[model samples]
Every structure is written in C-alpha cells, then in structure tokens.
Target: MFRLKTMIGLFAGALMLTAGISQASATELRIASGFGDNHSATRALREVFARKVEELTDGRYTVSVFPNSELGQATEMVNQAQSGINFGVYVSSAFYNSQVPELGVTNLPFVFPDRETAFKVFDGPFGDKFKPLFEKSGLVVLGYMELGFRNVTNSVRKIAEPADLKGLKIRLQNNPVHIATFRQLGANPVSIDGSEMFAALSQGVVDAQENPYSVINAFRLYDAGQKYMSDTGHFFDVIVFAGSKSMLDAMSAEDRQAILNAGRLATEAQRKFAKEDEAADLKSILSHGVTFTRLTPEEREDFRKATLPVYDLVRERLGAGLVDEFLADVDAAK
Candidate 1:
C-alpha cells in the first residue's frame, strides 16, 4: 500500500512537470490553405484560428494562415505537409485519394444525403478511419470543414435532365469515380487540376464543371465563361485540414493543442460562412447574368440513375468490406 501510494504521487508529479514544460515551449505555427484569400474557408480560418489558437495556448503559441496558392496548390500543400516542410492544408479528399484510395469512398456520387449527415459521419467513424492512413502517409488529419453539396455548372446549357449532359465535355477531378460518373452520364469527363480549371473552361477545353457554391464563386466560375448552372446536388465535398505527422510529432504539447484548437474553431467559422454562401449562391449568380436550372423529381432521378456505374466501379476498387463500411456510414447519415 505504501509503495502504491508513492508511485501514484510520482506519476502525478511527472504529469504536472510535462504540462509545465509544454506550456513554455510553443511559439507559433503556419497553416496553409488552397482557398483564395477572400474565400469563406480561408477568411474564416485565418480570422478565427489566429484568435482561438492563441487563447487555447494561453498566448504561448499562434497560427498564421496562408491562403490561395500563397503557400502552394492543394496537392503541393499536402506533399509539403507530408514531407514536414510545413504544416497542414485545407484540401479535398479527392486530392488525398491519389495516396489513399479508400478515403475517397466518402466522395462517391449520391452517397451523402445532406450536409448535417455529412458532418456527423466525417466527424465520427468514417473520419477516424482515415487518420491512420494519413499518418502512414506522413500526414495527420486534424479535422474537416465544409465545401457542401456540389451542383453541376455548364456553359453549353442547363442540365435539367441526364440527356442535357450528353456530349458536354466537363472538367472533372483526376479520379476514377468522378470520371466514371460523368462518362456514364454521357459527358466526356476531362481530368484537370483545380488550378487549371478556369483556363480550361475559358479556352473551351471543357465546356462545363461542377463544384460547391463557395468554390464556384471564389474562382468566379460564373464570369469565367460559364453561362448556366444546374441544381443537381450529386455529391458532397469536404475540405480537410491535414498536418504533417512528423511536424506534429516535433511540436510541444501546447503547440499541438494550438493547431487543433485553431482547426476546430476554423471548422465552425468556415461552416457558417459556407452555409451563407450556399443560401445565396443562386441569387448571387443570377445577378451576374447566370442562369440556373432546377431539376424536377423525375429529372433528378434520371441524373441519379445515370451514375449507377459510379457505385459499381467505386465498390470494386474499394473492395466489398470497405465499400460496405462506407455505405453503412452513408446510409446511417442518410
């Protein structure tokens, strides 16, 4: 009994010592984002994180955000973070799918039922599953923010029915799932980097594209040679902030807390801004002379049916069990 009491006291002392040391060692951290400086995600994170991180660290540490390609492209940012050149990135899971294909299961077409359901799953089991994958790749997933449900936008015509997308060359992310979806819909899906999208659409390399309201507005897709938008919310996209596992490991506890605190606060702020952006997307775009096509129930069904192969191919690539786990989350959330 005496030795056990002494050991407990010693463990308590060690914990206190570690806490004190953590409090003193951290200073500041840099965060990288792909969203433009004025974008909702970037602006909200930079503004909210700076204040929240300092407070969480008791001003022992701080966060500085670099938005747009200020630090670099999303893929480049992830590579940089993984290599421990810098810290995290506000990137898409589709971007991470190049390194971790199973993670892309979240981005499958018509998978998520709504935004609320999306937040729950990504913040719950599904998000947890990707953490180790990110860590194995030398990256650490902090958490997720929002990009919201995506709608198809085109210059050629409004897409009220699946037939409308036929023959339209659309810009797609470099992923098999997205490629399969567009191809099944009878459109030629052209894989293009996010950075190249504007120019590609402008030069007519692709006649249409799809993204969340925030993204379309941030890059001025409406003015960038796009004429019509479709309210076909086919998929949900989320921006993930993943840090360098090596860099995080090197951080003192206070600094680590600072990064996570900032991330949580940023998620809230980004979500609020994203909600507003989505609410106002159609009205705002119409003011710029853009047209929106709202699909009827039957038309939407037609759109959904066209992408059946997306499910088959994605499940095959992800394997039965992983795909089942993903669909379970999707169903639970739905």
Candidate 2:
C-alpha cells in the first residue's frame, strides 16, 4: 500500500482517491465536549472541528460533537474514548492529571509566564514529551487547545497577597494535583466537577472557584453572588482531544490525517475564541456586579514565591529533564 504522503498533490492523487468507495463504512465519529452552548472555548472547538473534518474528508468522515455533556460528562468521556466506544473526548488536562501523573506538570502553580507561553511550551516540548505518557496509557493525543488562563473568584473579601487566600474553600476539579497545589498555597481546596461548581459556590458549599474568564463568565459564577476575584494563572488548562490509540492506528492514513487536522483547526479556533473573549469576558463579570482585585506584580510574586516548591513535585514525577526542556523551549518562544 502506498502511503498517502506520496500520493498527495500529484498524479497519484487520482489513484489514491479511488480506494474509498464504501457506503457501509463508518460515516461519523462520536466526539464529546463539556463546554456549554455559547461558551467561547467549547463553541470554537465543537463548531470548527466538525466543519473542518467534513470539508477535509470530503463528507466521507463526519464528527458528531456532543456539546454540553449530552452524551455523558467530560470525565467519563475519557474511558469511553479509550474503549473505542467513543471516538474522542474534549477533556481538560486537570482531570486526566490524576490518572496519568506525568500530566500533573501542567497543574503546577505559576509554571508558565502567561497563556501564550503556556501553549508554546505545551505545543513544543511540554506537550511533545507528555503526549507519549497518554499513549502509554492506551490513548493517543490528537492535540492541545487552550481553555484560557484561570483566575480566582471568591465570595471572601478582597484578595491582595498570599495571606488573602487562607481559609477560602475553593472548588477544584477532583484531582490530587489540583488539591495539592491549592493546599500548598493555603486555600482549602474542595474537589468537585465544574458543572457543579457555580451552585456549590452560590449555596456556600464553596467560598470560591478557579477557572478561565470564559468559564467564570459563562457559568455566571459572578451572578451566583460572588464578590471578589483574583487573576491567578496558577495553572493552564490544556483541552486535550484524545482517543483510543488502537482506533487511531486502525484508521486509513487519510482518515488519520483528517482527525489530526481537525484537532489543529479546533486549536486555531479555540485560541481565537480565548484571545478575543479575554477582555470582554472579565468586563462582563464586572457588569454583572462582581468586584475585581487585580493583583499587582508584587502580589503575584508573593503567590509564586510561596508555591515555588511545586518544581520539586513536577520534577520528581515528570523528570527534571522534561521541565527543563519545557522551560527552555518556552523561554525561546517567548
């Protein structure tokens, strides 16, 4: 069998294209994502990937995206994808970090300077090194996209320094690394799904929660009666499009490239969604009457200084070389 790379953009393209005339073949792949309708991040990926895939594959392959967890919740989608009962899952790295400890590296506080640096590190060294860790666990990572940088919104009074974080029970995703990072930083971390977080905060089950502006704004955490907010890019959420390794291996080379291209298209759209929405999202919260406490550089450093030991945590599990490779590449990219 000739590889598609050799067939593309040549006279051989005609011969290569003739092999796929089966009407009985699988026409659609199932894709699950957790973003609520109208949310920027989820909207970008769900709509863009589906459209790009249909175009790229010339309608032979379709991706039916389940947005708003209509099929099942995002966390459960992983196991489904792994079983090949589902084709792919749109999941946050935070959720998978507990299962594949190497991913805990992403949850480390103050790791990347900002959102751009975060993605650069992930797309280059950090994500490259960590992609195989998923393969080892029977999954193939299609690609990484941004959920935007997370910030803290609390019902507590204004937060200005590390001491301000004390005793606030912030809801975190159910993962050890998320809990550990918050614990080390002095907040009482409450583990829960993002779907439940706004209500948990509203009813006093939690005093605060952390998420990207898109999420904070979309979930209407501010409307839930929160008062104070902090920009704590403590960690970056790399939305990973992943699925069964074997299923991907079973794909025809063209289908494999189509899936990969869709993931990239989704990322390009997701990044645009995040970048364009950042300013408006935060401002929208203010209009909803949530108070903002923008952290000065000194305050941010205070938080970073306290949580700096997380390097040991990441280096121990993910290898010092991994972090070094990540840091060097990100520095150059920045």
Candidate 3:
C-alpha cells in the first residue's frame, strides 16, 4: 500500500507540474487548411505564419499547422474556428459568399484582368472594405493569399473557344457564380467539394474541371487521367485566413498584434510562392502527357463575353448595391 501510494503521489505531482507549466508558458493553437502540406498555402502557414507568430510572441504562443484537410473539410474547419475549437482556418472567398452573400463580388468572372490587378484590389482599399464582412459571420479575417487564376482541365476535349465547352461537364468550386458562369458558357457545371474532385475526374464522373495549375499539380489531376488543360484564366481566387473572434479576444493585446503581423507576413509570402510556382507547375503537369492549350487574347475575350450575363445573376443574388461598390473598387484597382 505504501509503494502504491508513493507512486500515485508522484504521478499526481507530475500532472500538477505539467498543468502549471502549460498555464505559464506558450499557448498552442492549431491551424488547418484544405490544401496539402506540399502546397504553397500550407507551406506559408507552416513556415511563415507559424514561425513568425512564435518569433513575434517571444514564445508566448505556438501554432501547429494541419494541411490536406487533416482536421476537416473547409466548411467544417470554418465551423471549428467560429466555435473557438481551433485558432484559424484557411477558407475560400467563394465559400464565404455562401454565408455573407456580398463576398461573392470577388467571384465575378474576369473582374480582375491580371495578377497585378488582383494584388492591388485584395491588398489595398478593396481588401480593407471586404475584410469586415467576416465579423458578421463569426470570423475575423487575418489576411488573404492567392489561389491564382483558374483554368480548365479535361479528359474529353481541348477548350480553345467558348463553343468548345458546349457538351462537356465541368466540375466547379461550390460557388453559385461558377456554376452559373459555366452553365451560361453551355458546359454542364457540377458543384463538387475539393476532397471528392480527384475521384470524380478519375472515374469520368465529370468530364472536365477548372482550377489553377498549382491546384492541378498539387492534387495530381494529371495522374487521374486528365489529358488536356487550357489556360483560360477564367477566374482569379484568393484564400482567406480567418480566426474566431472569441478566441482572438481571449488573447493579450500584444499577442493579438503578433498574430496579425504574422498573418500579414504570411500573406505576402504565400502570394509570392503561388506566383513563383505557376510556370513550374504548368511544366510539371505537361510532362505527365497532358496537352497544354493557351487561349489567345481574342479567345479569352470570347469567354469573358459569354460569361457577362453571369454578373446580372450575381448582382441579384449578392445585391446590386454591394456589386456596384465592389465594381468601383475593381475599377479603382486598375
């Protein structure tokens, strides 16, 4: 009995010591994203944000990065953050549109003419105006990272013109604008979650899909039997880093500032990484035997024109007032 009691006492003491240390030292936070660890977004979170947070906080806080939907899908991760179960999650702007509505303004087809224009809008006054939309949805926007311009990948046919998309079934991000846009372009658009995209393409459940080159390579859509890719540059996307307001409010002011700084630095790094990896990813995808097709400026304008009707639906869904305000921002960016 004495030996058992001594062991129990020591174990209890150790537990108490651990609890005390945990209380006094750094707070640990889990950050999650739907993309793979090899992805630039995840790499930024792991290397830039996570490291910078620790450095900025002077070891007062540490972050654990979970990639490839290890924690959950994007929607589930957003719920986790909103409920304060996790510190942060990377979410798509289109996903936010499903909740906030007005956020879909960014999803308008061909709104951003190029990468430079996108950066100006998202990092400048446009980003500032849009960031507050998350607060109403139980999230606080940390910063934005590029997902790059989306292009078409197909096992069926090469898309050189809007007419070429006529009979193909294309998988799109779960955004109404994307679906409507493709539908108007005469292709059947199927809204599928990112996790299920590969199998859908592999089994021919969908004849085609559109995404950035980074996504095409990261997800290995080529390995899934995708034979052709088009540089349509139809839509440019940015991933939003969002946090739980309650969780952030629980932090010390200094710690909160550290997180904000870390997020801003990570955004810059993530954008740079995404842009830098584009040409290489395109080459990597092509080396796998997929035919690469680049749309001419006239061909791209054809697509732009075909999708113009999409803006009316967007304005109706997101409200004309919000759409006008965002268009002004888009114009200002140019």
Each prediction's whole-model lDDT (CA): 0.81, 0.78, 0.86
- Candidates' TM-scores? 0.88, 0.87, 0.91
Cα lDDT tens digits, model 2, 216-239, are: 888888877688888877777778
- Model 3 Cα RMSD, Å? 4.8
Who wins the lDDT comparison?
Answer: 3
Q: What alpha-carbon RMSD in Å does predicted model 2 have with respect to the real structure? A: 8.0
Error of 2 at 286 (Å): 0.8
Which residue runs of candidate 2 sit more than 4 Å off their true CA positions? Answer: 1-26
Which regions of candidate 3 deviate over 4 angstroms?
A: 1-24
Weakest 10 consecutive residues, lDDT, candidate 2? 17-26
Clashes of each: 0, 0, 0
Candidate 2 has a TM-score of: 0.87
User: How would you encode candidate 3's per-residue C-alpha lDDT over 51-84 as one tens digit per residue?
Assistant: 9998998777889988888888778888888888
Q: What's model 3's lDDT at 50?
A: 90
Candidate ranking under TM-score, highest first, comes to: 3, 1, 2
